[model samples]
Target: MTPLLEIALLNIRPGQTEEFEAAFAQAQPLISGMKGYVRHELRRCLEDDHRYALLVWWETLEDHTVGFRGSAQYQEWRALLHHFYDPFPTVEHFVGVLP
Candidate 1:
């Protein structure tokens, strides 16, 4: 498996969690079908209505940089979810350091 991965931390606007989730549910299928995408998991913080994390695993960094960014679906993804964020989201890439 490729080592590159991404995690996006998001803070949704207050009272917007449900709207955000509904939008994301619509986009999930498109995201999963993209080139080089291995998997993604969306999690909401149990105690917070405005917090979420998206753990996205890909085959390579290029899967996100080249494939996802260049695809038309990205525009849809952005359109569907961007406005729900409070200060936009932060994306961090990582490599597994221990078993």
Candidate 2:
């Protein structure tokens, strides 16, 4: 099956960028070790310091929506990182089209 790319646009609370990043650093390992995880990256928006983009590649969609989201580790991930967002982020999946 084709790998899936998960994208999330995060808008962090004002004055919370540093703390949010610190929390994300700690939470990264949780997603990385999941069953179908291929790779991932987190990027900060240059124009908006409080905005971030998270990209994660997975072997299959279920590996993330079911496997990871269903695991206890996700709870830990959420606890560590969720509070920093001003408005919750939207997560979407993509499949390679051209190459």
As for model 2, its CA RMSD to the true structure in angstroms is 0.8
Per-residue lDDT tens digits of candidate 1, residues 1-99? 655679998999998899999999999987899888888999998988589999999988888988998899999999999999989888989988877
Identify the leading candidate in terms of TM-score: 2
Q: Which one is best on lDDT?
A: 2
Please provide TM-scores, in order, for all candidate models, with all chains considered together. 0.93, 0.97
Q: Indicate the TM-score of model 1.
A: 0.93
lDDT of 2 by residue, 52-76 (tens): 9999999999999999999999999
Q: How much RMSD separates candidate 1 from the native structure?
A: 1.1
